[model samples]
Target: MTLYQLHAKQRLPISKQEAWDFLSDPKNLKVITPDHMGFHILSGADRNMYQGQIIQYIVKPFPMVSTKWVTEITHVKDGGYFVDEQRFGPYALWHHKHFIKEIPGGVEMEDIVDYKLPMGFLGDLVHPFMVKKQLQKIFKYREAKLIELFGKMEKEENYLVLRKI
Candidate 1:
């Protein structure tokens, strides 16, 4: 299986603790995701994240097809980083890492995802046309949603500037 990696980063005008508090809670995912994706938490999302935490959700990744996804929070470092791996999902494999660091004016959050599709060559063939575009769209929606919620912190030349919303 060939693993595909996706990386996304954004700077927000918020504290590291605030970013951690929001991102570590699985319930907040639907808030940042696009509504058309039908992302909804089914269980284990009402509390704070912990190592070995399992979150279940129902998502309509394709039209008229509802899929059940289960992921486990395998590793977590308070206010720093966390790793989530798919236990049962559409993908053959999914390992995602979330990182947050306090930057000059706020916090910089980063996401790194490594995933592989189920049908091997067939999946690879469709990836560029389908999966890759879908993932990119998801992350783009997430970035805009985050900026809407916390405003944006941008580096202007030699300094970081916090844009007021």
Candidate 2:
């Protein structure tokens, strides 16, 4: 099976605690995500993030297509990093890790997502034109939303890279 990985990094002019507080709260995900995605938490998001926590949501990844996504917060290290894996979602496999570190004047946040689509060959064929592009747009929107919420670090450019693994 072909597994795709997405790596994104951004530096924010905020304290580690500040970044942790905002990111650790599940509700803030909607704030950072694009509105057109129709992302909404169904349950398991009333409290702060913790290991074993399960969050359910509805997302419209494509026009006229809505799906339920359930993810488990598999790992969490206070103020450092956390991992969330798909329990029930569109992808055949989804493993995402979020990392935060204190930088010179602020905090740097990084995300690594490894996933595989379903339908085998059919999935692979559509990935380049559909799935990959969609993911790129989503992350781009996220990057812009984050910049709007918390000012960016001076002269530091955020980046996102997707590759096969």
Candidate 3:
């Protein structure tokens, strides 16, 4: 099977700790995702994101249909980075790493994910090219969603965790 990698980066004006705390909370995902995507936590916040924590989610890419995914946090660093691997989902394998660094200007957030879809050759034939556009759309929505939330909560020393897009 071929491995797929996705890289995304963002610069936020917020403090390191603030960004870390916000991103560290798994429940906070709904807050930063677009409403149209219909993102929701299938499992409660019992496992807020510790090593071996399995979190479940229900996401609707469009309007009616939805997909369920379960992921486990494999590793975590206090304020540096964390990794999540898909335990059960549509993909053959999914390993996602989120890295954060404190910069002079602000905090830099990076996302590095390695994933492989199901159906081996069939997945390659149909998805590799089409999936890129879909992912871009999702991330764009996330970027805008972050801008709105951070903008609303903007204040001194409270950097809102990202640049206003």
Candidate 4:
């Protein structure tokens, strides 16, 4: 089995509390997500994020292909970090961790997602050509949306890295 990991970090000119408030709220996901993805919350996102919280959504990852995705908020540490695991989704496995910390003039948010594609070897074959690129595009859109919502840090460069583990 081939497991892929995507690591993304961005620094925004906002307070730690501000970042935590926005990131911890499940509803804000739609704001950061690309509109082209046709992402919508089906349920389990009415209140604040908590452990064992389950959120369901409908996403169109590809044209004419809509899928239901359910994820559980497995762990949450207030303003520090949180973890979400896929209960049902397109991927064979998905474990995502989000972390935020106070930086010099603002806060730095980091995301690490470890996932495995379905269909075994066939999944591996398409990773480089399709899945990887799609994920990169999503993260790029997220970064841009974040910067638009909360101003970017001056002269700071954020990064995204996707690799096999």
lDDT by candidate, in order shown: 0.84, 0.95, 0.73, 0.95
Tens digit of lDDT per residue, candidate 1, span 8-94? 778888999999999988889999888888999999997999998999999988778889999999999999999999999899998
The lowest-lDDT stretch of 10 consecutive residues in candidate 1 is 156-165
Question: Which candidate would rank higher by lDDT, 3 or 4?
Answer: 4
lDDT score, candidate 1, position 143: 83
How do all models score by TM-score? Answer: 0.92, 0.98, 0.83, 0.98
lDDT tens per residue, model 4, 68-155: 9999999999999999999999999999999999989999899999999999999999999889999999999999999999988997
The sequence of per-residue lDDT tens digits that candidate 2 reaches over residues 100-147 is 999899999999999999999999999999999999999999989888
TM-score of 4: 0.98
lDDT of 1 at 51: 97
Q: Which stretches in model 4 have alpha-carbon errors above 4 Å?
A: none
Report lDDT (Cα) of residue 85, candidate 3: 91
- Candidate 3 clashes: the total is 2
Error of 1 at 7 (Å): 0.8
Cα RMSDs, all models: 6.0, 0.6, 5.9, 0.6
